[model samples]
Target: MFKSKLFDSIGFIRTTFLIAFFILIFLASITYRHIKELDKISYSIMNTYEVSLELNQLISYIKDAETGHRGYVITNDSIYLEPFIDARENINKSFQSLSSRIDLDTVKQKQLSRIYDLVDKRFYYFKNNFSSKTEFNNDFRNGRIVMDALRKEVNKMLRNENKLLSSKDRLYRYNNSNTPLIIFSTFLISILTLGYGYMRVIKNYKDLMNQNIRLKIFDESSKQAEILGKYGSWVYSIENKTFDYSDNKFRLMGCEPQSFLPNSDNLLDNIHPDDREIIINAFKDIEIAETFPLLRYRIIKKDTLEIRHFKTAAKFFTDRLGNKNMIGTTQDITEDFNKTQLIKLRNKELEQNNKELTEFNHVASHDLQEPLRKIQTFISRIEDKEKENLAETTKAYFEKIQEASNRMRILIDDLLQYSRTNRSEKKFELTDLNTIANNAISELSESIKEKNAQITFKKLHEVNGIPFQLEQLFINIISNSLKYSKPEIPAVIAITSTKTKAYEKPKLKDNSKREYIKITFKDNGLGFEQKYAKKIFLLFNRLYGKNEFPGTGVGLAICKKIVENHKGYIFAKGKPNEGAIFEIYLPV
Candidate 1:
């Protein structure tokens, strides 16, 4: 019965294989014919491209020649005659090039020859008329006739070429229409072949009942272990001398199951030399005592020679027939190991960098403050002691120095604030942004009063933020609005906020929670060009001169730093002469 069943299966497989072979033959024939058609189409396209290029060159040459001829006729300048002469000399070459590319059809060839003859005749008449000092009107009339005839012949050739191109394009469309049918047929054949293969597997399982029963328990347990550990198993039979590998087991070894089989000797050979002995001893212990069901080691990939860490556990099991089988699983731990090492190295480097930056900022800021203090002190002394005795120009110079010193002081303070923002720990809480905006407005009351600015506030939302930093951000932005107000209009400052639900807070290193707050600060000020919107955030960037707007350009820079420290972003939008709007997005 078994022999008869085997013969039946063989016959079935043979029939299916024959069907597959015939399908492959059909596919190959279609592909071959398609390739030939494609080659012809490609040649036709290249010829068309060449012909078009030649025609364009000819047109350009004719236009240049006509321009030069007209200039020489009007101005009687010999210099203008050079281009005409050069074009006349090159005209024959262009005609020859076009003639060479024309199709070998008699009509097309004859048309090209006629065009060439007419162009030659026109050139000869032009040259003779110019040399003999013939009347311009007669020469022009004859030249027009010859050019017209030549143009007619060229147009005829172009029509024939375009017809041929259209035919080729239709052929391409016809071939494309057949492609979908061919692809569908190929896919159908593939699906039928795969179904046949699946059926064969099922039949084999049914016929090999005893062997299947023995493997059933082992396969299920191996699969369970693999899923639990993100691993897979393999086995090498000593007596039968056959190798078996699971799908994931082959993947862990960086090999295909059909290409490489797992074996004791092959596995050992692929292991890192330093880890080989360790794995061998572990395997031996498991085999001898049958006590442990797990072993772990590192192996090197054959292609990359990179060490891949692995952990495996296995046991020897005997069937009812006393056949011994070894089963084991391997887990790849290379990624986990590498990630741990990377974390350690990065943490060390970051700690060292943080220490260096902290010291640098402290020393740099302290050193810069001393010189600024001396300048301020000297300027104050000059104004207090020598005001009346000094000349007007000298006094003006002293005032300028004092203004500069004051600006420098503000810059230094802003710089310190910006640097401190980077190091300050955020203390997030529900804070009223309306109160913050009011406080900033109150702080700038003197400037607002001087400028006669009309400031308005809408109901602002309470958002999650560091209160002090939020307050500082509000002050800088509001102060900027007052400073750059339009000369003609009262500065109109509007403050408003809206809750944003869709906003995502940027993740911190510790993976903390965040929220979002949307605030808009609009001002009717001497607005800048839109291009300067982003640039205004950079330190020391000023759109207007100090005489026009007086402030250290660090205000926006500080606002940007503070917003970023609070896990937020600020963007400006404005057009020349229009009002500026600053949008701030804060994460709660």
Candidate 2:
């Protein structure tokens, strides 16, 4: 609505200019009128000033004349008479000027006439007294009365003129103050109005230019995207048997952009010999199909002979004249295809290696166990037969040999369990961890009894996991707590479980959006430092010497493998002489 009223009237720019012009003209006219008014008031005040001066001069002359007359009558001095004479002439001249100045005021003119009459009477009385002593005595009282009346009249006239002067001066001052204010107000208003209008006009124009520039930028960006994305658009006109490929399409074929018009023969020539028949069949089928089918094929670059993968998708379109056309995009998928192939190759290689490793672990454990068992059996027989007769050093050496064989046996057993944890059948079942923890405790009954360990657990959450592995996970952690208990302190192991979100476990880097069952194995055992939390899970990693803790350091490694095979995670937290907590997360 504002645009219609302003812009449609005379165009926005022109209308704004016209409005500014008129505002300036209006301001100038107002300023001129105020100045004229100020000048008029000033002139009137100057005239009033002259009247005030005249009134003061008239009073001064009257005083001088009275003094001269009094001095001449008392001392009879002619020198004093000169002053009196000059004052008399000056007094009449001042009165005449005062009368002319006050001609515009009838009341003031009347007051002046009365004052003149009283002065004339006082002059007559003084003239008669100046001549005779007896006449002076008789007329002295009347002369004093006339003199008093003249003074009263002059005072009245002076007061009236002063009031007139004051009124005119006030008017002049008012005009003087209002003139500048009026001019400044008008000028400021005009300038502000013009500034606001021009600013809006400029802003609108810039906005329009920016919109146009943005549209051009978007168009350029779309073309640049097609080129940088290694894709190009094409339109095939079936009626004319002509193919129109974009500039990028030509470049994708290893020809100069827009070098030549493309046709079916040219496209087929670039196709790999193995995929040529497939494209030919697809093209023939699309001629009758209602919807276009996606086609993938390989093409050989004309200049470099380099093979490139291309995928094309088109839609069937009919023009107004019923001409059949196909519009499609062709993307160069060489890089993506190569990456996919490499990933597949890596996955196959990893699968074969894992199978070989699993087989080797089982075979090695099986083959090494026979010798280990035979050595242990022979050592046991030797101890039973000669331990009593052997010397003390020989007896100690025999005991050490038995201890080494036993350790070797345990190491092979633990190694087999660690490998089997990864190769075991991974079948998920809804298993209650309360049952699993109880089962682990049952398996460690002998150790728990020896240490007087108090193993505590509550109603735990059930989760989807491999049940046997979950059982083994609890056994390994609880067994560690039993083995590492502080001296003279009964081992206290607490097993607790709760339903929790994956994000709550900061150490478990997995799918954080899922829910999991967090089972905590907290124990008051001889805990290690916090820094060795991750190190403890590594295979063959031990925090204490073999003499201090008896086990191949592969127990926790087996526990980690079991949890991972069940798609879960385990981490440990420890503080010296305080306790250790082994936290496990299994998806629910």
Q: What do the candidate models score in CA lDDT, each in turn?
A: 0.76, 0.83
Number of clashing residue pairs, candidate 2: 0
List model 2 lDDT by residue over 152-179, tens digit each. Answer: 7777766766687678668767756766
Poorest stretch of ten by lDDT in candidate 1: 502-511
lDDT of 1 by residue, 140-160 (tens): 888777777767766766677
What TM-score should be assigned to candidate 2? 0.60
Q: At residue 217, what lDDT does model 2 achieve?
A: 99
Those runs of model 1 whose alpha carbons end farther than 4 Å from true positions after fitting are: 1-308, 311-329, 339-355, 386-394, 501-515
Q: How close is candidate 1 to the true structure, as a TM-score?
A: 0.47
Q: Please, what is the TM-score per model? A: 0.47, 0.60
